[model samples]
Target: MELWFTEEHTKDVRFTIRVDEQIESVQSDFQKIDVFQTPEFGKVLVIDGYIMLTEKDEFVYHEMITHVPMSVNPNIKKILVIGAGDGGTVRELTRYNTVERIDMVEIDKMVVDVCVDHIPQTACKLSHEKVNLYFEDGLKFVKTKENEYDLIIVDSTDPVGPGMELFTVDFYENCFKALKEDGILVNQHESPYYAREAAAMQRAHEKIKKVFPVAKVYQAHIPTYGSGHWLFGFASKKYDPINHMDEEAWNKLLIKTKYYNSALHKGAFALPNYVLEMLEQNI
Candidate 1:
């Protein structure tokens, strides 16, 4: 027997999920993480009631999330990842030869331990020599460091539980201070159709706009996340997402991708009228 999850992303598209018996399940005092065997997405990790990652669709999120900034800033060396307990972001970040070190700050040690032990499909990157792991709050760890990183990627879980604080204005300011003048920050901004989630994204974007000279919202479509369409918040000081893409670098470094390409890179930034309206009206 199998199960499925589906929703219409747009008038032209519908996202679907089909799953078999669970491959793995972990319940902590704070949350429950489940990995299920899925036909379309291979193995999917669900934390609490939210879809965290799917082996099949993971590349779309991880690659787009990691590559967009790196493609813009070529010299990024010291990378900081917040709340990516499973190491998928680190895995993608390592693909960049310029990334010499990765400091992954995660709030839950249990999540790290569980992923390292059971979710190798997504957690395999932690074993790499370049990654330095820390079990601390993403907000607090970022405060002590100032102008130290070239890139910071926040692979935070959906805003809930310990992940709640990572979405605040204070956290964005701390990240700005912790980043080098040229450093860039990118984080999951969640879905657009769900009003509550959309407002959260807008609020976060507004805060980032206040502190960072360059703050933009880009989106991707993932089957597991609500409404399939998802958005990411980008904040930077010296790099412009619109002006910074190096065609030679992106095309050369291109990996096998089911979604996300140089074309989508440009297309993704072409926000629909409503998004533009939000970006403008709110500012």
Candidate 2:
């Protein structure tokens, strides 16, 4: 089997895998879901045929997505996870005892069922008693909820198909409404190396900043994502990531981490000069 990942100029990525002679869709039950097994990366999870996460490097995505905001505020009791079907974010969220309730709103139940059945390594923590599974639209869920969470993590896939609404300004406003006074929000923003899509991410950062006072953009490295460089949208009411680094708590939280430690957490924010310039210009 020969596998190739190509970054299309259309701002959408495509991964092609040829097994033996011809390529056939392995898992196609879900409308836009595509699951594939890779030699190096283990199981690759995709939605609408867009690659979301791979087994080998999923820790980087999950850790940065879940830990960055959680470590900043050690008091996040109730958390809302939007669009994390594979349970990677749930796994990371469960690490902290303070996280009592996780309202996971994923529209596609098939993604959760498939991952629960197939990807035990990633989905193990979603089965925890603290999680409240909501098989409904995240947009609608956010609209109805109020002052329920200390942290809201937007773990949605690329802004397409079922996840398109998750990227809208209306959704961010609802996230602001659903959060407590000192609530914080983080979303898996796309890659910076990919210019057009990165521009879209920059616009997203702009849109989020409009609703959340302490909105900022951060970075992470995940091998499965294009360019291996990812962005995270940080939105908060009072907490600031730069001023609120809890070194002791961060160290304490790292005893069980493989992909995220104090060093990696610190290094994730060290962006290149050009990227920094872009963010500055956007700001």
Candidate 3:
């Protein structure tokens, strides 16, 4: 018998990966966490039966999510990251010396601990002196903050289970209030290739547009994720991701990234006609 890990991307779609061995598995207070070592993707992290990241392609997701907003506004000093328990997002943010503080709010502590133990490649920065970890519900965390952060990254999981609330209009409204006048909020906006995820993506974009003055969608290809085509939401109070981008200034920092660059930054927002059509459904 062969042991494999499978994730249902939808009712009719499933992605499976061959597993060399199950490294670790734990039932956290919030969800089930598992780590597997594979010949193809190296170390893989799975949360609640959903693929979170893999050693092979995690860079694509992390870099695009962090560097896009940073390149657009390089002077951002304070950032609030909600739900990136793997610490990959914080690791990328810490590369900027201009970033003075990072407040990371994660709903589960076990996810962080497990990632720290089994997936240190991405979890290594969880204890950086600049990062303050808060193990609490992100929805409730943002509700108490107002005009406090220069950048807010909602690196949440799918809009299900504990993450369901993070996708609501109320949460986006609270995020709008939590950001400074020029703050930017970037989140993992699900894929558009599948109808199930596409519907969620459309709903997210529609709700965000209602709260932010400028809301746009960007794309990146991650092999382990659903359909290998992932979308991210960029919402800002005043700046347009492309028009306000400081390419010259960002390049001067000499930050090294595997999947994000000045050229890719501008091109990521060019959505296909089908994706554009879906995004324009109600907006």
Candidate 4:
């Protein structure tokens, strides 16, 4: 018999993948986590029946989220990652030798453990010397921190379950306060294709725009995510992802990437007219 896993991307749309085996399944304190082996995507990680990352296409999301902001402001040193338990974000950050400290606050320890055991491609750098892992609520963690980190990457799940608060205005306000004057905040801005996801994406963009001096959205093509077109929020106190981006400096580092390149960096911010109109709506 063939094994297949399906997720409801919308009430009418569904995504299915052929699975080789169910490697692990566990009910954590927050949500259900599952790991699967598949031929097309390699190791797949799912949370609450939503696809998070797959080994084959994971580089797109991870590199786009990390390198975009890093390239814009190469002086970034201290970093905080909220809710990225798979360690993919930190894995990319470790490649930057100029980065001094990396603090990852993931509420679900099981996600980290399972990913490290089953998906080492994305989780291999969790134990890096510069990384300090904290198993705590990211919302509360940012509250205690004020003007501490140079960058904060909100690598959260969708705006539901435990991640609901991360999308609120209060949380974005706290994130703004947690960063230095020159700090940057990059978040998992949901896709703009589906209705439900688009609303959340617009709301997040509006909130961040209100709080930060500079707020913009960028797109990436990740086949596993809903609608396959994903957006990431780039907000900063001083830097503009496009105008301030030091393409020459970033190229000088010779950082090899699979999905993100300096040329694409400028192109990603050129949002589609529909997406731009959606973002422009006064919600």
**Location of the lowest summed lDDT over 10 successive residues in candidate 3:** 1-10
Clashing pairs in 2: 32-48
Candidate 3 off by > 4 Å: none
Q: What is the number of backbone collisions in each predicted candidate, taken in the order shown?
A: 0, 1, 0, 0
lDDT sort, best first = 4, 3, 1, 2
* Candidate 3 clashes between residue pairs 3 or more apart in a chain or in different chains: none
**Model 2 C-alpha lDDT versus the unseen true structure:** 0.79
Give me the overall lDDT of model 3. 0.94
Candidate 4: tens digits of C-alpha lDDT, residues 1-283: 7999999999999999999999999999999999999999998999999999999999999999999999999999999999999999999999999999999999999999999888889999999999999999999999999999999999999999989999998999999999999999999999999999999999999999999999999999999998999999999999999999999999999999999999999999999999999999988
Error of 2 at 66 (Å): 0.8
- The TM-score leader among the candidates is 4
lDDT of 3 by residue, 1-283 (tens): 5779999988888999999999989998789999999989999999999999999999999999999999999889999999999999999999999999999999999989888888889998889999999999999999999999999999999888888999999999999999999999999999999888899999999999999999999999998998999999999999999999999999999998889999999999999999999999993
Q: Write the per-residue lDDT of candidate 2 for residues 1-283, one digit (tens) a residue.
A: 3655433435465545432221223443435655666666777766655667778888888888888887889888999999899999998888888778999999888888878877777899887999999988899999998888899999887776677898899999999999999999999878778776687687777788889889777787776666777888788999887678686886776547767676666777778887777766653
Q: Report lDDT per candidate.
A: 0.80, 0.79, 0.94, 0.95
Shift in Å, residue 113, candidate 1? 2.8
User: Candidate 4: global Cα-lDDT?
Assistant: 0.95
- Candidate 4 residue runs with Cα over 4 Å from true position: none
Cα TM-score of candidate 4? 0.99
